[model samples]
Target: VSCIARHISLTVGCCWLDGENQPHMKAVFPTEKAVHDHFENLLRILSYEPLYAQIRIKRSNDETVLVGSSLIYFLFIVQMRNMDWLSDLNTTLKNTMVSIIDASINDEVAMCCYGVLCEILTDEESKDLSISDNICNYFLQMLEDIWNKTKKKYEHVPIMMLLKGFQTLSKNDSMQQETAVSNRIHIFIEICDEYPIAYDVIWALSFNKDIQQQLRSDSPFICKLTQLSRQPENEQMSKIIDGILWNLEINHENRSMTDKHNTKEFDIMISYSHKEKVLCKQIYEELIKAGYRVWIDFDQMHGNVMDAMAQAIEQSNTVIMCMSEQYRKSNYCRAEAQYAFQRERKIVPILLQKQYKPDGWLLFIIGQLLYVDFNKYEFSRAMQMLHNELKVELMAETHTAPVRPKEDSVVAHSTTYISPPEVLRSSIVSENILDWTQSQVQDWLLGHNLRQLSRLFAACDGRSLLYLSKYMKNCEPQQILDLLEADSVRRLNESISLIELSSFHSVMHEKKKRLPSMYSSNT
Candidate 1:
């Protein structure tokens, strides 16, 4: 019986591969009975200590090892397709797969191991499998090793696999809380600079507010994003980078507003069924953290429910319907949608559940409109899509008046126009200050007084400050109290006149013109 089972397993493994390096294809089982029998035999063999021991010894031989590894890889591929199979896998089978991942010399075998591990960790149905912090760390280390080996070969398959694994792992809140996972995410962002395939992984990591905060604090990562944004060929990458930057900027602005007095209207109103409040609240928190002023019933405890809901939908610039089966059934949610529609507000439909489809009245209202799929990508990627949409709407609504500043005010003079020091100070103090590109800073500082420009240049380091000075020819200034360190920022408390600086420059230019002629005549 043992000999026959081993032969059948090898045959099944070979058929599973289907002569392809990739293991995504279906196994060529001879019959329905054969498929059931093959898995039944696999479970029995993997559970039996004596049989598994014999298989391990056989795996030592070169020819037997290849077949044995293929068999294990095949099992993983099967498990990925049918997560129910994982319920039958005992500790012995799980450990065997982990061992194969740890000990495998072949990249393809390792990739398969990681793929299965990801499936077990991420799939909702496979939650029985134990995935400890140490195990997660081991998987991340293995992924890094594979990334270093395969990144140069233009083999994005392994990196993509690893990213999928990371994305799956991130879905678990416990795994996300692990310090090791957080460090891995940071390292992965660095890897993204070399491998564009890892960008999606970065996007997944960004969904976690903690990870986003970490990225915001990381100067090098922000610099990498800024550099990538300048590459016209990297349009998709640029879009992701822009979304992250926009989120960071908006959050900063929102925090600043919150700290001070913010009288601005809500950017969005969230409507959903009370039954789906958990998901709605999660979306609400994410939106608020991303910097949008969101109005939801959770924050409106003091108001009349119907009246407040109507007022919120009417006042908000956009209404986001958290579309789900429950939402469709809710009368209140429908009323909010109708009011937003009647008010001619921009209504963004977001599909909250994987199985949710708009139907009947809800379908009539939102069916014609394009919606962002929260279930399609990882949460952060979907949030980014929604954010990009909101950003576009916000940009469209931003209309600057043609009114000019008074002549005596700083804005009247091209060279002496100083922005409120408080505004510049706030930007300089922001965690995302480094995210500002050179061109953006230049644009902001344009037409400022020479001394203020000098002070600004002094705040930056050597080369950048020198480069900025070129734009300061018609600039303004406030005296620098102290020279700032390369990485430090200090607010200028006092303002000074640009008249002295401008006169000094004029005198210097006059002297320079006469000096050349004077030297020539003397010679």
Candidate 2:
């Protein structure tokens, strides 16, 4: 049994790939094929005659049941569209699960069974025409049965999945006052602190004004959320707390939507599927630390989602596109990506999964943008490249942009104005800052009394130089000199001086007075 369990895990858990053919740290999402291949074991297990079973797995070990059920969960929630036999599979699994639950009360396998069904019913992708309203009601009936069976028990497992399922139902106005929902909500509030799954509770009750007020007034629960928020290591839970605060209007130190991040104009908006939350959160944090105002959904899909998303994207100067198979397939992500494209938001695509190419609509949406593959580059190197790209002020490009591309094939949005390193090395650059030559750039800077910025401008162009101008429009000459000297030294990775602003230019005599380089010893 253990050997079979191990084999099942190994079959489904082939996440990382090797060098060309060797080994590396790249984590690739398991393909639908691999999942279906492993799913055969589940069929074998379910098609059981305890004595005649060729696999010789023991009935006593519930671990096998758990593993098989987990795989089923993934199939239903993550890869349902790929399963042609899903309807039949669902029936077989439902019957088998009923047998398991009848065999024992409050069993872990039974709990998982409920959780899987609830997850599937609530999944955004679970809207196939084959999965009808009757099928949904059948699951709901099972949930009611389980709740009744375990009401006296009142365990987390019973409440855990049932509440999530209820949360989904609560979204419908017709279902709001349903008896089952009311029964669940009553228990959900009374025993809320007993379960750690606050995410489900907060969102399920988001539209309910009375419940929102009720949860807000629950001082102990709010305090518990505070403690969860403070533990930096519990990042997933921390995000959950943030969401809870947002949903219930719980205002604490650093725990409200009224914070600057909500109101401020965003520098970058990240459009991603929830599967990539961890990496996206890391990117968000890094950007925040670097002084860029970033916007991310944070899985907080509260009140008028489309309106909120449009506002965020509108405020952002650029959108970071996290590309993965899930991202490509998700309708929600597709909507966000399409909107960003339509809004003419500058997009930077990053590959969040290995070997997952965008085909249909995603291909159309991103076109030919060069995406940074995490598989090829380490995180640090990738972040450095991202930071460098974002440093050029994105907002400045609005004025410089010409007509939108009529041709749909891989239109180079930002590339038209931003020159390559080799091109920047030459005197002339291109149309916007992206297109202008170095000499033209420096000449403009010299006129602005940002002469010291010429040194920093060696590798800089586009919105970056213009951002510096807008940033320092009100700054004193000494202040500009101080900031520029610091930036140049850090960027060039050498100690430069205050006097260096007026001191040197390799292109000073080479180019005409259009922009004169400051006098330096090298001059």
Candidate 3:
């Protein structure tokens, strides 16, 4: 602790103006003894009332500011040792850190102290082990706010130090396991935007067995990063930025996504049929009035049935599938079911009829996962499940998971619906599969007009058709079906972007001698 105290000013090269034209570095601390005294006294006070200690340090004057360093080290020790102080310190430290950040400080000594303070305060280790929902939530938000405020000025030690702090904070199993890992990653990516240099800290930590092992669970972050990593270096960097933004938006959205329809702020998509529309719309309005970014077919799909539905589904954080008799009777509902199943989006099936049981493929999915039974109209309990799901998704996206499929992978559940054994026989189709180009797929999506998707969906029916049309409005669904039905080579190529084609193809080719011939005629 004392060594850190003396090394601070010297390493930072503190300086200030005087009467001379030439600038000069400021004087180092008076003595080693003074530095030790400075550190010891502060820690003694912090270990007393963690919260109050932070308040004193944050509100102190220049003469008393040394308490900041003490508070910083105190938090570090608490985190490294996995002490009980963390739960209490997390709350008080967050409040103190915010206040200190907002306070004006012109002195180099004070700034140096601030840098060390942030470095210790934001340690990801602090987030580990003991889970407290309120503390994790507050800490996650603070890290995000600090990252946004400091990213542009990352050259400063204080800012760089904060990054380290966050890295340590993320390592704490208590905090890391709490679901803020994704948020931490998001903030790191946001700061690293266009400048990969900033990723050094996280990249290093990512190699840690403890960190990587913890992040290996199933999560959307894993899927998103895998997808982002395969893009061209330039685009990969940009997508890193996008990944960060996506997590932030998702985390923020989760708060309301889980709330009851009457209380939720966002308008979530309700994937149901005309019969379930009343109940579905009720949930939708509930989410909307509560302050969410809800997407329904009525607002945007009018132009193209398929495109609208696809757009709404893709844009939504949650998809409520009302499982009523009418819902199953409609092919449209089945199509919507297929779409949600493929995307691996959050799908909550509310079984309205007592006799109806989700079986085969749907049962395999919904059964393995928990869902709300609406046969008896347990509105309150159903809404609670939605809230819990929303929270789980947010946490999952924040921490990078290993099993979630990357974007380049075949649409997750596509294989369930599109069987390749039936489409491998045509020679022209087989050859096309071998020749099918990813560049062609990119060109197709980029070239097609998004506005025309609905007209093409007119041939299909239901919510699923609507969902597809929304995203692929420019491309004809028949062409997509045709492409999908072709040899595996063609389908594989279409699934990934041209920029990522070579690498992915190489991986696939290494695993198998000849690429499977599946869907080609559609291309």
TM-score per candidate: 0.38, 0.37, 0.25
Write the residue-wise lDDT of candidate 2 on 213-281 in tens digits: 666676876787667656656554555565556556554323232332222255577889888888888
Residues 1-523 of candidate 1: C-alpha lDDT, one tens digit per residue: 5465466555645544453343323445544455555565654543443333333333344433543444454444443342334434534455656665445455444455555565443323234454354545755766667666735321213345455556555444455456334476766776775666466555544545677778778887788776765564654565455445543442122212121122225667788776667777777777766556566766332212334454455445678888865565443465568657766678888888664557645776875665777777677757655654555444334322222322322111111112211222232222132344543343233323232443333334323443333344434432222222221233333334346446535643553365666424432
| Top model number, TM-score | 1
- Candidate 3 lDDT at 326 equals 42
Off by over 4 Å in 1: 1-51, 54-59, 62-114, 122-131, 150-160, 179-182, 208-210, 227-239, 246-523
Shift of residue 79 alpha carbon in model 2, Å:
13
Error (Å) of candidate 2 at residue 305 is 19
Ranked by TM-score, the better of candidates 1 and 3 is 1
TM-score of 1: 0.38
What's the CA RMSD for each of the models?
A: 24.3, 18.1, 24.8
Cα lDDT, model 2, residue 468: 53
Runs of candidate 2 exceeding 4 Å displacement: 1-38, 44-125, 132-187, 204-241, 248-316, 321-351, 354-523
lDDT top scorer: 1
* Best of the two (1, 2) by TM-score: 1
